[model samples]
Every structure is written in C-alpha cells, then in structure tokens.
Target: MAGPVHPARGVSYPVTALFMVGVFLLGAAFIASYVGGLHAPHPHRVPVAVAGPADATARVDAALRREGDAFDLRTYPTTASARQAIQHRDVYGAYLPQQGRLLITSAFGPTTSGLLRSAFAPVAAADGLRLSVQDVVPADPGDPEGLVPFYLVIGWIVSAYLVAAIVGLYRGMAAITLRDALVRLAAFAVYSAVAGAMGTLIVETGYGYLPDSPWPLTGVGALCVFAVAAATAAAESLLGIIGTALTILVFVVLGNPSAGGPWPLPLLPAFWRTAGPWLPNWAGTEAVRNAVYFDGHALTRPLLVLAAYAAAGIVLFLLLAGRTNPVMRFPAHSTA
Candidate 1:
C-alpha cells in the first residue's frame, strides 16, 4: 500500500475553500439583486397632491394619466392641505396650479423631487407660467442628496452582524450555556447603545448633517443595531458559520437593494418595492429620516419591526443556547 495517503489541497484548506466559494456566490447574488431591483425605474401610480383651479389641476392630472397613469392625483381643497400631506409622506409632490409652484420634499427623495420638476415644469409652461419648485422638507444642506441617514443605518447594520459573526467564530457559534447567552445579549445591548450614540455624535455634533433631535435617531439606531445583531446571533446558534453567510444574504444582498436607499420606492422594481419596507435597512432608514426631517410622523412601523426582530432573536438564542460550530472547530494540521 502507498505509505500513507494524504488529503488533497481542497480538503486540507476546507475553511478557505468554503469561504471562497461562499464569497463568490454572495458576490453574484449581490450583483443580481441590485441590478434586478434598480435596472428599470418605471414609476407608476406615484401619489401626488394637486391643488388650485380645477381646470389647471385637471390639465396636469390628465397629462399624468396620459403618461400611463404615472401619477395618482388627490385633489386637496387648499395648498395648505397638500403641504400637510407632503409632510405626512402621503404624497411625493404637490402642484399648485394657480400659484404655478410645485412643492416637493427632497427629504422624501431627491430623485422624486426631480421627477416632479420635470413633470410640472412643462405643464406650467404650457399655460404661459413659470413653475417654481420649492422643497418643503428639503434635504439637509450638508446631505443634499438625503443619503447620509441611509448610509448611517447601513453602517450600524453591517457592524451589528459582523459583531455577531466574529464573536461566534471565535468563541463558538452558540453560547456555552444559558447564562452565556444572556450575557451575550446584555453585552450587545450596551454595544448597541454606544453605537447609536456614536452615530448621532458623528452626524449631529461632528458635521451637523441632520440638525434635528438626536434622541430619536439614537433610539432608532440602538434598536436597529440590536435587532440585526440578535437576529444574526440567533441564526449562528443553530447553523454555525453558514449562518453568517445567510445573514449577509438577507441583510446585504437582498436588504440593501430592497432598502429604498439607493433608489426611491416608486423608482424601484415591483419586487424590491414590495420587499423594501420589511427589512431592517428600510425600517432604519425610514425611521432615521422620520426623526431628522419628518419629526417622527411615521415611526411606529419601523420601531415595531425592529422590536419584533430583537425580541424574537433574543428568545430564540436563549432557547437554542449551547451548540458546537461545525465549520469553525479547527482540526489540527500536524500529521502524526
């Protein structure tokens, strides 16, 4: 017999191989998800508020309808009412036909404002009037694109999941016992709080990007961070290292595209639009924006979603505590 058969390179470096393949697949999925979500931005039935003379409102509404029902118009009795709707995020833009002004919320979405300008400018010109666009809830001067909030929340989520993954890889995917799991949760809570505060500090105190109340952002940040971390930790407890990959798939590959960040909800494909509001990225971004710009007008949904994830994750992690990591066990490389 041959003296002693040895494992091939593939078997010897199994961890490296697994990670390489996992990364490759993840990269592909990343491309597919983003491309599929944003490649075609056919906005249809976008809600808009129209006020002023019936004739002008009808004219714009007719034009919008002729363009494949691009806008679903709601006739408000007064410009004040239309402005209120925009603050509530009920409408993307309001066209005051009599005043020949378009009220938009860049905070709602920069692209959305641009779209409104494009649509209303020509209509106003047709009537021999110059359309003046005003951003009622304008994006922060520092963050003219209104992308910082989304990016900030994305940073929190990424760190949250990475923390869970790293902790699992080093100590074991699952907790060593009930106490261990409890401790882990508590530690993450503190970490989440710190992360949230630090983000606020950087955004508000450092750059004054979002010159609104800091407490709300802090609360949302902490909740979002804890939720993602707990969710990832719960998955790791049961699935070992593969759980991290699954976490990335859910949070990054799918979550980012469906986040309503890189693109507005109306501009996104149907799948992403339907899927956006359910993910942490979407909830977090919305909540942050609500705090910074909308004065927390619609924060209940995002908060509820984050709380559900955090609660369920903590419960599951506790129940499923104490398990071995199948992949990260690290067998001895030395041969006898």
Candidate 2:
C-alpha cells in the first residue's frame, strides 16, 4: 500500500505535467506550421520575360494570364535582352516566341527550372512547336539541388544564437559590465571570422560545390554570422533569459518559413513573400548566390540590411550596459 502524498509533492506532479504539455505543444506547432506553409507551393506572380513580335507577345501574355496568374510578364525587344534579364536576376525565365526556346537559370534552383519548364511546355505545345529549354546558369555539380546557400545560412544563424546564449549563460545580464559586453563582442567577431573561413573551405574546396572564390564567400559568411550574433547578444542584454526565447521566435519560427530557401519568394503565400526580403535568412542566401553565380549583381541591398542589423544590435548592447552601471563623474572644482 502507498503512503499519503505530501502537499508539495502532489502540487509538483501537476506542474511537471503542465510543463511537459507545453513543450509538446511547442514542438507540434513548429512542425505543423512549417509543413502547412510548404506542403503545396503555387506561383503567384513569378516574373518571366518574352521577346518576339507584338502579336506573339500579346498571345503569350494572354495565355499566361489564363494559366491562373502564374507569371508577371515583361516584354523585351530581343531574345538577347531577355537572356540578359535572366542573368541579371530580373526574371527567373525568358521565352523566345519565334524560336520556341525557353531560357532559365538552374543556378537559382533545379526545382524552379523544372517548374518553369512545366509551365511553358504547354504554351509551346499549343503552337505545335516543341519547347527547347536552355539553362543559362546551372547549379554547381556538387550541389545539384541548389540548396547549399540555404543550408549555409542556417548554419551561421544557429551558431550565432548558440554562441550568444552560451555567453549570456556564463555571465548573467545583471552582472555584465560594459567591458564584459565589449569582450563578448570581440569574441563573437573572432568566432565569426573563423567560422566563415571554415565554412567556405568546406563548401568550396572540400565538397567542390560553390564555384565562387573563397574570399567573397567568406566575407559574406562573416558578415552574416556577426549580424546574427550581435542582434542575439543585444536581445539577451535587454530581456534576460526571455531574450533567448525571443531569438528563437524571430530566427526559427518566422524567419525560416519566409526565407525563400526551398521555394523562391514569388511562389510563397502573401505573408511569407512580403516578409522574405526583410529577414536575414533570405538576405544571406541571396547574397551568397549572387557572389557565386551572378557576378555579385544585386548584392548591395542585402549587405546594407545586414549592416543595419549589426549596428542596431551593437548600439542597443552599449545602451543597456550604460544603464546597468552609470559612470561616476568627478566635480571640476576638486583637484587631486
């Protein structure tokens, strides 16, 4: 026979059960949200260019619109101009109506190229012509799926927050001085440099993926790591333990889905599409891609966004440090 339970013990049982239930709910929510967002991706207004006679262009535009708003159509004077648009990242794919040729960049992602092919094949078939596909920029052989950029960004993000969390745990926010904060920032910088170099080596040399020179990739990686680490440190300084939770909420819950990693931004739902460009994941991924494939076209915007985040985080951290320990001022009237 069991003895009667103590009051504290009985209370603890329900508390433990509640905590377990909360953990389960959080896990369940993460899975459900990601799966729901990515289950069936449909293009909303994916940009595509067409170059041909005015009559042919009008017919193609009408067909694209009839296909359920799958494309945002642009007209180019020549097929060469349309190809240039694809290379410049202005359009995902281009069509030459007269030649029945489709120009796509598999460098973006094989899935994107596949989708474009499927969408345009029917249009070409309607004209009793076979669609001739041309990949102007194909992905590296080592990363045929074109997911290396996304995975690389993910690695940087996880390392950034984990490093910040460990530092915060070692030195509680209340006990952290301005010197301590600066030291932490210094450590983060060194770690970012090392991590960036190592990651670049692994992706470029070891695996033979990512055709860009290591220097540019390493530079972008370092910036990405520093941006995330500084922001996470600032969050922790301001909010204590809850700051870590906030970091996860921002980087994991919202950032990942809207990152345009597995699917391009134009194919996502409205909310994710709108939010993708603003988030670090998308910025970092795009920056890496540009550095590798597009000769660094359209890189300035993402770099600026990352710089802003790093600056904001550093400023906030300093402000918090000042609040915690006010500097003592000596009166001018008194001499030593």
The C-alpha lDDT values of all candidates are: 0.86, 0.81
List, residue by residue over 1-336, the lDDT tens digit for candidate 1. 345444332355666777899899999999999899978776767899999878878887877776786788899989999999988878888999887899998885567788889888888888789999888898888887779988999999998999988888767789999999999999999999999999999989999888767898899999999999999999998787788889999999999887777667777888888888888989999899888888778888888888988998999899888766565555433333
List model 2 lDDT by residue over 82-146, tens digit each.
98898788999998888788999887677788988998888888888899999888888777778
The list of candidate 2 runs beyond 4 A from truth reads 1-25, 322-336
lDDT of 2 at 87: 76
Most accurate candidate by TM-score: 1
TM-scores of all candidate predictions against the true structure:
0.90, 0.88
